[model samples]
Structures are given as C-alpha cells and as structure tokens.
Target: MAEPGDTSVLATAKAKSQKSHELASCVIKEPLFSYAHLQVLNGNPLQEPIELDALQVRSYCTAALQQFLGIAGTAISIDILKVDGSDCWLRVPRDSLGAFSAAITAWRGTNENGVHTTFRVKGCSDWLGSLVGQVGQDTLWSK
Candidate 1:
C-alpha cells in the first residue's frame, strides 16, 4: 500500500493527462458583429429632402449592395433596427463591415427627384446599446 502522503501511480497519470490537455487546448474566440448607424442624405444638396421608411431603406441598401457587390452582395444579411426621419440604424456582420461600408459608399442612391443620394455611416460598434446611447452630431458643437 502507498503512504498517506504519496500519490498513486493512477493519480500521477491522470494529473499529467489533465496538464497535457490544458496545454494543448486553445481558447476560441466568439464571433462578433458590427452595428452600423447610417444616415440617408440627398446627394444633390440642391434637391429637396427624400424621406424613407424601413422598407425603402432596405430597398435602397439592397440596390446599393447589388450594384457594388453584384449577386454575392445580396447574400449579405442586413437587419434594420430602427428608422427616424432620415436616420437609420442597422446591423451587419462584423467581418463584412468593411465590405458593406465600402459598398454603400461606392453606390449612389436616387431620390424621388431622379437625383442621386448618399448613405453616411455615422457610427459603428459591436454592441447595439452603444450605438443607441451615442450623442448626436449636435453634441459636437456643445460645450
């Protein structure tokens, strides 16, 4: 029989096995998505304002993605979180954030006046609440 203070051969082997597993195992990172806050603007400053609802915003975004990324762009998913006036809040895959933003900038939106418009990305974050709590552009001028 082994002494009280002595560990058994099985115990030593089990400890070594656990140590090996701890060393060999790698920490996996959780996938994240970036939430983008976009503002639709009239490209032609001279043209009247073009107000858009949730559907119209999605439609315009779809068109932009189609124009910039072709058929593949359509595969990218977009969730419209909210729409207030000309401002829009949306979410896109974090990995695709760059491509999505680039596509929006590259494409031009046409207003009811037959004039082109632009999509301005005001802010982007992985957390939805962060975007919601952010200050508006007006805050830039505040003391």
Candidate 2:
C-alpha cells in the first residue's frame, strides 16, 4: 500500500549504484597509448653519443613499438655504447623506419639498408613503458 507519490526505495538505490559505477569507471585510467604520438623522425644523430646498455633500451623500444604500433621483429642490430648509461645506440632495418619513429616519438639509430636515422624518444607515457637503469660502459663488450 504505497502512496501514489512515494518513490520506490529499491529503484532509487539502484540508480545511485549505477551512477557510482560510472564514476568509478572514469577514475580508472586506460593505459595511455595512442598512434597520434608516434612518427618516423628524420635527421642526423644528435650530438650526444649513444651509451651502454643499448640492447636493453632497444628491448624497451621494441616492446613499446609492438604494444603501441603493432610492430615486432623489426629491430636489427642493437649496440651497447658502454661509454655512458643513457647513450646506447640501435640499428634496425630501414623498412622498420616507419615502425619505430614517431613525430611525437623520438627514434634514433641506423637502418639495415645503411640509411641511418637517429632521434630521441620522449619518455614513453604508458602503463608498461619504463626506463630501466642504463647498462654502464664498464660492462659492455663489443663484438
């Protein structure tokens, strides 16, 4: 025997629950990855030299490329400079050119076709992207 104007307590609660869920969804950030931030950078290698642990950095680079751009196995040679931690250098196939470089991205190094392109990647802004400590030169052994 509810009054005509009376609101159903259960209905009001369900509506509030749905609203709370929507608010929660907004708070959950999806991994920040967008093709809009990627591009093939064209230029000379920067004045800064590539450093040690190039292999490791390249690994991160590869994963990021695959995760963000859907490219894999495109990398060719990765050299660890060993002079400085952050100065690692990489060389991949020229075909990979379009795959690695992003205008919003910074790609550096040579390609397999002997066409070299060096650019720096701005820090990756994704849940999986991370900067591991550089591989120091003291530990590098060139082939």
Candidate 3:
C-alpha cells in the first residue's frame, strides 16, 4: 500500500535483493612452494611417522612451520585419514611444517616478489570450514 505523503523506496529495494547470485566473494592467492613443512602442533594421530620429532632429519618445529605458511599467506588445514593401503602417507618435506600465530587474524595474501604463486591448502585440507585448526592437542586427520 502506498500512502499519499510517503514515497517509500524500500519496497522496490526488497524486490531487487531477492534475486541474488548466491555468490560470496573470497580472496584467492596462488601456491608458494612445491613442497613445504606443514606443522603438526595441531597433530593428526591418524597418520604414521606422525610424531615428527621421532624422525632423524632436520625438520622445522611445528610452530615455525605455521609461521612460514603465514608469511607465505596460506593456512595449513590437514585432513588425516587412516586408510589401510598405500593411500595413507603424505610425504611432505622437512621444511613443510610452519608456525601458527594469534596476530594472524585473517588469511592475508601478497605477490610482491614477481611470482604469481598460489597460497592454498589442497581443498581436502579444509579443517572445520575455517582457517585455524585446534583438536585439543590430540587430533587425527580424517581424510
């Protein structure tokens, strides 16, 4: 109903809002290293050699691994699976692990080094539909 003295613009605005594209925008950056250490400060008991400290190589500590990924503008969300066969191992490099931080409020990106690398975890590594991973210190990757 239109009142004679009131020219309401909201009615038309409501109609336009109803037909949306259903698309939510997100920031996308390219990958950084061919192989990098992904931290297990957030551990996954589902994978073998999971205790990275038990390994004999010079590996980045979990905290450092998260930080390196942060500097590269990527979040490491791992999905560990206890599969029976050869599909169970993710042979990440010794430097693949990185550090996590509280100052890292949002996943940020940059490409200032003349490199168009993508900062991403494989889509399978989406933990809890969010960037940060915390499994009460004793977690398992379900992928």
lDDT of each: 0.81, 0.41, 0.31
Predicted model with the maximum lDDT: 1
User: Would you list the clashing residue pairs of candidate 1?
Assistant: 43-117
Question: Could you give candidate 3's per-residue lDDT for residues 18-114 as a string of tens digits?
Answer: 9767578876453332222123222223434323322311222223334545444234432232222211212232233232222122223223344
Q: Rank the candidates by lDDT, best first.
A: 1, 2, 3
Greater-lDDT candidate between 1 and 3: 1
- After superposing all C-alphas onto the true structure, candidate 2 shows an RMSD in angstroms of 13.5
Predicted structure with the largest TM-score when compared to the true one = 1
TM-score, cand. 2: 0.30
Model 2 worst lDDT run, 10 consecutive residues: 32-41
lDDT of 1 by residue, 91-114 (tens): 899888888888888877676657
Model 1 deviation from the true structure expressed as Cα RMSD, one decimal place = 6.8
Q: How far is candidate 3 from the true structure (C-alpha RMSD, Å)?
A: 16.0
For model 1, the superposed segments whose C-alpha errors exceed 4 Å read 1-31, 44-48
Q: Arrange candidates by TM-score, highest first: which order?
A: 1, 2, 3
Winner by TM-score between candidate 2 and candidate 1: 1
TM per prediction: 0.69, 0.30, 0.18
Model 2 alpha-carbon miss at residue 127, Å: 34
